[model samples]
Target: MTAFPLLDPALCFVILTTAVLAVAIRTVFAAVVSFIVFGLLMAIAWVRLGAVDVALTEAAIGAGLTGVLLLSTVARIAKHRADRGDDVPILEGPEPDPAPTDPLPGLATQSLAIVLSAAVAAALVAAVALLPVPAPGLVAEVGSRLSETGVESPVTAVLLAYRGYDTLLEIVVLLFALLGVWSLTADARWGGQPGLRHLARPDGVMAYLGRLLPPIGLLVGVYLFWIGGYRPGGAFQAGTVLAAVWLLAVMAGLVPIPKVSGIRLRLALVIGPAVFLAIGLAGYPLHGAFLGYPPAIAKVLIILIEAGLTISIATILGLLVAGAPEERPS
Candidate 1:
């Protein structure tokens, strides 16, 4: 029904090819690069499917933040190997030769893996094929009650109003995950700045972009949060952008990594979920239901919640990528 029908099929093919390459690639870095490409392609597919909110989230978190995290991991692994005098190249070329003691998967194990993968693929195909024609969904229901949610964007409304509890839990999960990472820090390094301090030449491209991009990125991130009330932009995407901006600044040596124990840093990490929970509790007194916003000021409440969430999400995401503390506090 649309122009350029071939576009969808072509995109799908590329996506599948990239996915295969991501898993089949010999080098971890190459596979990660392929995975990032696959994520970006998936974002494009989401856009073509008329899910712009999903597309933004996919591009920002799935491709951008996740790719950076994986690359960081690769760098760390390479550093560790070098420290141990392993002579293994983590990012470039093929993996180091396997130790003679290392055993490859046996023929039976490989066969079982192949069979399981095929079974899973067939099950997924069956599920899609069995989906009802016209595919039952809550589009109409969400539309009818959209105004009451105090957001013009259905995706925003669903995330912040209708399924707010789930969103809250997701934030909490991120916090917990970050805590788990922090717990991995050495006792001597506890409460110290996260990851390693980055050094870059002041005249280099990274330093130049770090100086140039933050102001623009800050504006865009805030705009995304504000526009979410009426469009396909929201806290998650905005936070990811802000996180990337922060990471860039740090990597360019424009800003120092904050101590994990810093009061302000800790506050920024919890403020979002705290605000959401506070609002939810207040709703019990105001509307006899948790997370219920009073009709008169629902929009104001939602905006407040999103603003807090944006800050916390950005902090948590940046820290997640920076990883556990590696240096003792000064």
Candidate 2:
């Protein structure tokens, strides 16, 4: 019989605290910060569940990239309000009445939600608890075919070969999102620098750190991509790190954000998808199915595809963080 796992009391406490603060913090900025912490805690939980690939994704995209994106948006909001001569309010709902000062609005509604949440939690626990002693699994099959896929990592084999179609769609979706962000630029600000520009101040810690970090980050990012076929890293994780480095440079005002309309910038955003499509199309003549790699050069082709994807993913994510242009080009 399967045994129920004991909860880690410390992890549970941190998660609850961060989650409550994320919803309850009066200021939007504080709430967003709390939410970022919550994402990181969730990443830890994913790791504890023995899903290392999911954990990397949760850390790179969920916690790291998403946190930076939200923080940037928050800065934009604060700037927008401040520029309009508006006094920024804490902006919160009314405190719940301790005593029954009149009928408590939504009390029954809140109670129902709690009950529903508890029911869902109990159901999940029961399901896990009742899992078969020899749980059904597919690790053996994945391992057996891993060598044929020309990758040492079973996870990479699944992503690049078995589920290649799904990966292609995900890449295209990223491109579509990039197009949307670019479309939001004002006509005047079209092709202008993205996000806010920082003044050239070498004395600031941000600028100092920005200058210091990119080289190291770049090295690590490349290593992650290179080792992904045999290890825990991959295009998304590596690309996110590269994107973070680029964002840091832009945020520090050390480097200007590229214009949306720049040819090179546009190419950076689309090249991966374009290359992927080209290879997939070639499969019709060279192989029986789409995205099939010639067995002899499968590893080579996979590496090439991942390289282009890393660049494009980095570009798309960086632009997402920068957001649409609000000001016209100088």
- Tell me, by lDDT, which candidate is best: 1
What is the C-alpha lDDT profile of model 2 across 1-330, one tens digit per residue? 225345566778999999999898767778878898888888888877777878888888988888877877776766676688766532343323346576655988889999999999999999999999899888899998787878897888888778888889999999898779878877877888776566757789999999999999999999999998998888999999999999889888888788777899988888888888888888777787799888877888788888989999999998888788866777
lDDT of 1: 0.93
lDDT of 1 at 146: 94
Model 2 lDDT at residue 217: 95
Clash numbers, per candidate:
0, 0
For TM-score, the strongest prediction is: 1
**Superposition TM-score, candidate 2 onto the true structure:** 0.84
Residue 34 alpha-carbon offset, candidate 1, angstroms: 0.2
Over 4 Å off, model 1: 97-120
